[model samples]
Target: MEKTFKNLEIYKVKKAESVQEFYENLSLNRPGLTIPSLDTLYDVGHFNVFTRGNCGSTGPVSYNRKDYYKISLVIGEGILFYPDQQIVVDGPALLLTNPDVPYHWQAGSEAQSGYFCLFTENFIRNRNETLRETLFSRIKDHPVIHLSDAQATVFSEIFKKMMAEMDGEYIHKFDLLRNYIHLLTHEAVKICPVNEASKPTNASARLASQFIDLLERQFPIDSTDRVVELKTAHDFAAKLSVHVNHLNHAVKEVTGKTTSDHISRRIANEAIALLRYTEWNISEIGYCLGFEYPANFNIFFKKQTQSTPKAFRKV
Candidate 1:
């Protein structure tokens, strides 16, 4: 069957002849994925406030998945759940969810109010280089933020000002919105708590973070580089300037997995992406994923995915 966003409860806002037309055409019944073309969809905009309603569904809501990034300021009670985490917003809080991951929410019955702004990812990404990571990373696992009353007041005022600007005939209203978004991002990150447990101050946590950073930097691990560095836990430990045991301890302490587990998971994640997204042959994909021999790659892939690379790719 052909994929459609209507199958999934997703709404795409296309540029309309008038604001009334824009709102009237908003339909939240789509499925699969929607990629917004800047020319056709960028002009549609809304400054909406919702109070006391369920989030409508219990599935992942992806912002960038359908070509937009959604920014929501929670003014009431709700809980957003991702696969591995949950964020409870009981008061004024600003949350940003990227389209890369799926998210869902369950709002309380006692009147949940919030301001929502939807815009194309390109529209926001063009304004700042770091926004891709800041806005879209899996960091929403750490999304619930505690804002002081004063800070919340400031955010409210800014939202009101942006709403007013949208109503005005300013030539640079879009530019102003861009700046306002940047400000909002800064404020959200400032109020959000650091994932200290995830990034421990202890010797082990420090080592694990460094190891993870290094591992991530060496993504799409080609066969050539794999032959040189990170072929084993000991190799990774030496690079991190720590003993293998210490490195393993750190990784296990922070991630509940050994150094080898992290390495295997990283390799597996890359392999899955390659299998699903690219048409590379299994052997070539294995080579690119750092296996000297296709057989070795096959075994590793099977161990991690419970199926051969080809089988997993088919699914």
Candidate 2:
């Protein structure tokens, strides 16, 4: 079963009673800055801004373990970020993030120089369905981009326009802002290097895409459940409401892997990542991957990689 975005908690910040209160609250929990209703801009929902003084800082700022998707446009001094890799954004750069990924930033001390727009998954879905897929699938996979002089000028103009509209007294200023945001996202996508040829366009390809999407939702598949639930081609085929042969054919045609093969490989890959990245014990790790018995998980792990889970964890 695919998990819906609604299940994920969304946070926004609105009213701070006082600047000190806001900074104190944000330094403790950054998500408060974007989660709606906790502040005054509840009507705007899932969108908020933080200037220099709002979160008073004279030097670089670091936010550890904060989970949210943000688009930051640096207008003056650049910011340095260290996530899984090191990234630096000097002038007029856009930074995208999600909760699954962690990041910290070092900002320069200056006047109200840069702008950050934080949005939720709902905001992305409401704006454009495909935008979420494209962004989540590609943005972080590539390197940070620094806009050219011409691109920077265009982005600066758009930012200025948005600020003006946000400050305007017009009744439909938010609607206008929404359109400007769309334009901004479209421009960002234009620079991203997505492998268009790899994108599925045909009906079979669409089905395959949906299948992968569904598979990811049931993620962290445990070793025990792996043998019971999606163990056979017919099991997944039935869940997908397609004939076993057809499912197998589509899976092979689109991804060049059989249904069972894909499942096994995904489970193996996730096990390796967890072994390398986390300190969870073998039994706990087995439970996380859906295995009821540690012994069974060890057998499967050894069969796949010719190494015990402990040995694999060490390597």
Candidate 3:
């Protein structure tokens, strides 16, 4: 069956559109997966259950390009779709989806049983290193890894414990749940292939992936207060701790495009989206796109698309 966001429902969080809204759209919350109100999570995140026969339809889900990350323990069959790839989850699997990448899923099995935790990067607090690990970056190609029965049991217990603590009046339950999330991901590394779960094959691919990931993560501009970063190849290289030449060569060899081309293309795409969807003035749009002056943005837009931002917006 075909599905779209309208056919489902628009979930609201904090009386606005936020990541927590995605958590509410699911029709079923199994017994063990407890979801606290979005308002209650002042600084932490939400934990929830995923059970089979929950939501009626299992088709393509709308793309999510907001803040927050999700880790799901799914038992059943499903197809995880990315822009470039799709993974088959024919058995119990551990899946990680981050804000940097957008994906949708389709169910293949008649029954689905699992637990999923949704949280932002801030929820983990001190362990920012865990969030930046290589494991989270393989969303497009290696999104899901089928788990052994024993491994599934281990993860299932962790989710149960998380829900149990949440059910109690324990004050640091969120913190404890964060630790359990770490434990869950840490255990998953053992099951995935040694090569795929770790760093890339070559230094160039590593630099290319890092650069692309860093660039992508800054996007979907969650709020007007937020603006684009890493607007230039040199800025991206500096952030990646690599020389500009090295970064350029790596990106070109891996992607068949120069580093600047990627940046310009991404920025141009954002500019178009802003002009088309937002009511912001040209200056505001330009400012958010890292353009210091309106004229400069106008020239760049014309160069990229043969039309000025104002002119394009009119069309």
Best TM-score goes to which candidate?
A: 3
TM-score of each: 0.46, 0.46, 0.55
Native-referenced Cα lDDT, model 3: 0.67
- lDDT string, candidate 2, 1-315, tens digits: 012111322222222122234345666746545423533121123544543333334433444433235666665444444333456455666665553334555444344355665554333433113233544446544435577768867766777787777667999876676676677667776877565323555766666666666665555433433432454567677888888888778776655456776566456545665575567678876767657899988987777657788877665
lDDT (Cα, tens digit) per residue for candidate 3, span 1-315: 232223533221212225655555542444444445664242233454433353324433554444557778888777676544557677889887765455666666567778877776545534213245434443324567788898899988988887787677888777777778778766776676546554556888788888887887777664678888778888988898889999999987655567897788667766766776678899988888898899999999899767778778776
- Mark the 10 consecutive residues where model 3 has the least summed lDDT: 8-17
The Cα local distance difference test for each model comes to 0.58, 0.55, 0.67
Best by lDDT: 3
Candidate 1 per-residue C-alpha lDDT over 39-154 given as tens digits, one digit per residue, 9 for 90 to 100: 32322222332222234434544321222456676776666654355566667776665443345555543565556666554345431132334433434445455566788787
Which stretches in model 3 have alpha-carbon errors above 4 Å?
1-17, 27-53, 56-61, 127-130, 134-141, 198-208, 212-234, 237-315
lDDT of 2 at 191: 79
